[model samples]
Target: MHRATFMELCDLLSPALKRKDTKMRGALTVEKQVAIALWKLAMPDSYRSVGNQFGVCKSTVGAAVLQVANAIIDQLLSRVVTFGNVQTIVDGFTALAFPNCDGMIHGTHIPILAPEHRGDQYVNHKGYFSMVLQALVDLKGHFTDISVGWPGKMHDTHIFRNSGLFEQLQEGTYFPDQKITVGDVEIPTVILRDPAYPLMPWLMKPYACTLDSSKEQFSYRLSKCRMVVECAFGRLKARWRNLLS
Candidate 1:
C-alpha cells in the first residue's frame, strides 16, 4: 500500500491542513480518510458500499473524495508532474500542440455510471456517447490541458475550438509559438477546414514511422520521444482498469 509514500503525502499536506487548535485535533486523521476515499473513487464502489467498508457515513465518504482528490492532484502533480530539463515548450505537448497540425488531440473515455453524472454534460455528446474530448497531454501523460465535454458526434477539431482551448492558445496561455503540431493525426496537415486556420510548420508523425535506412542505423538514438506519451497512457489505462469495477 506504499506506506512511506502515503505518509510523505500526508506530511506534505500537514502544513496547510493541520491546525494548532488542540480542540480541533480529533480522534482520527483527515489524511487517512482522504486516502481511503481516493481509493474508492479511483475504483468507484457504490457510496453505500464504501460507507460500509470505511465504517463511515456516505456524507463523510463524499467529503473525503473531494478533499483527497484535490489535495493529491494539487500537491503530487505540482511536484511530481513537472518535466525534467527537457526543452519546456518544444518537448512539452501543450507547448507544442495548439493551432498546429490541426491541433491534433486524442480522446479517452473513463468508465462511470449515468447515475453518478451531474447531467448530459458529463456524458453529453450527441447520441449520449461516452464522456470524451480532445486532450493535450505531455509525453508523460499528465493532462497539460483539455477541451471540455463535447458530444461524441462532434468533430475532434470542432471540440478543440469550442472548448476554449483555441481561445486560450490565441492569448498565448497554451502554446507560445503557434506553428508546432504536438501530435500525429489521422489526416494530412495541408488540408484545412476553416479558412481562418493557419497551417503550422512543425508536424509530428510518430505512428506512421518510416523504416528508413537511417532509422534502423540509429536504433539506439532514443528518438521518437513522443512514445513516452503512449507509454504513459498505457500505464494510466492499466491502472484505471485495475481500479475501476
Candidate 2:
C-alpha cells in the first residue's frame, strides 16, 4: 500500500478501532494496530513474529489483526467493492467486444489451514486444503460481488447456486432488464462465465467441450473476454503473498 492509501485506511478505521486508554496501560494507537494487521496480512508472519517486530504481545497482535480487519470490512467494503450503474457495467464489457456483458464471474481457491473438524471437506482437487472465493469482476477487473467460505471441494457451479448473487437473480432484484439485438434475436444483458456455470437469461457460458469450428470460435471469444477475471485474480494473489500459498 502507498503512504497516502495507508493513511486513508487508518483514518477510516481509527474511529472504530480506537479504544479508551486506562491507567493499566496506554492503548496502542489505531495506526499501530492497522500497521500490525497489514503486515501480518501482507506477509506470512505469525502473531508472535508480528508482535516481536512491533514490540507488543502476540495476543495483542492477533487481536489487533482481527479488530482492524473487521473495522475495514465494516467501513470500507461496500464503497470499495460496489457494483456501479448497470449501464456503465454493460458499456465496459461492450467496449471490450463482449456485447451485453455486465461482468465476468469465476472462482479461485484460497489455501488455508485445515479446520479442526471435517478437514477432509476442505481438501481440493489440487490435494491441498483451501476455501473457494467466488467473485464477479467488471471489465476493469474490479470486484462487483464476492462470496467466500465455501469448501474447496465444492464445485464452482454449486457455490454459485448457493451465493447471494444467485438469490438476487432468482428474486429478480438485481440488474434491470436491458436488451441487445444479436442477429434477429434480442438478448438480455448477461454475465460471462465458463462452462462450469449454467446458462440462464442473465448468465452466458460457452458451449460444452466440442470440436465444431463454430463452437470453438464461440468458446475462444468467451474465454478472451473472461480473461479479465483471471488477470484480476492473478494480480490479487501476486500482491498479497499470504493469499498465494
Candidate 3:
C-alpha cells in the first residue's frame, strides 16, 4: 500500500484501535499496529516472523492483526464500500452499452484450512475447504456490496438469494424508483450476473440455451459489463496475495 493511503487508514482506525498505556508498558501506537496488520495481510509471512520484524511476540502480532481488522470493518468498511450516486453509476454503465445497469454481481471461492467442526460443509465442488465471497461491483470496479463467510459448498445462487441485497432488490428498495423505456417496455435499474444465478426482474443473465442473433448480441453485451466484476476480483487477489492461498 502507498504510505499516504496507509496513513489515511491509520487515521480512520485510530479511534477503534487506540488503547490506553498502562503503568507496565507503553501501548503500541496506532501506526505500528496498522503496519503489523498490513504486513501480515500483504505477505504470506508467519506470525512469529512478523513479530520478529516488529520486535513483538507472535501473540502480540496476532492481537494486532485482529484488532486492526475489526477496526477497519467497524470504522471504514460501510463508508468506503457502498452504493453512491445512483445516476452516476447508471450513466457509467450506459456509456458501456448496458442501459439501466447499476452493477455486476459475482461470487468467488476463498480457500481456507479445514475447521474442526463442520469442516465438511466448507468443502466446495472442487473438493477443497473454502468460503465464498459474493460481491456487487460498479462500472468502475469498486465493490458496492459484499457478503462473505458463506460455506463454499453453497451454490452461488443460494448465497445471493439469501443475501440482504436480494431482499432489498426483491422489495424494490435497493435502487431508486427510476425507469427508462427500451422499445415498448419500461425497465428499472438492473444488475448483471452469470448464468449460475437465477434471472429476476431486477437482475439480467446471459442466455444459456440456443441463441438467435438478437439473443447472442444481448448476451455479448451483458458479458462485457460483467467483466468489471471479474477484473475487480482479479485486482483484489493480486494485491492481497494472501487471499489466493
Candidates 1 and 3 compared by lDDT, better number: 3
- Which residue pairs collide, candidate 3? none
Q: Which candidate is the best by lDDT?
A: 3
Candidate 2 matches the true fold with a TM-score of: 0.88
Pick out the ten consecutive residues of candidate 2 with the lowest summed lDDT.
Answer: 236-245
Candidate 3 residue lDDT tens string, 1-245: 67998899889999998889999999999999999998887666889999999999999999999999899889989997988889999999999899999999999988787889999999999999999999999999999999999998999999999999999999999998999999999999999999999989899999999999999999999999999999999988786664435
List the candidates ranked by lDDT, beginning with the highest: 3, 2, 1
lDDT of 1 by residue, 45-118 (tens): 87678888878777877877767667666666657544233244333433433222222345555444564444
Residue 115's lDDT in candidate 1: 44
Q: Is candidate 2 or candidate 3 better by lDDT?
A: 3
CA RMSD, predictions in order: 8.3, 2.5, 2.5
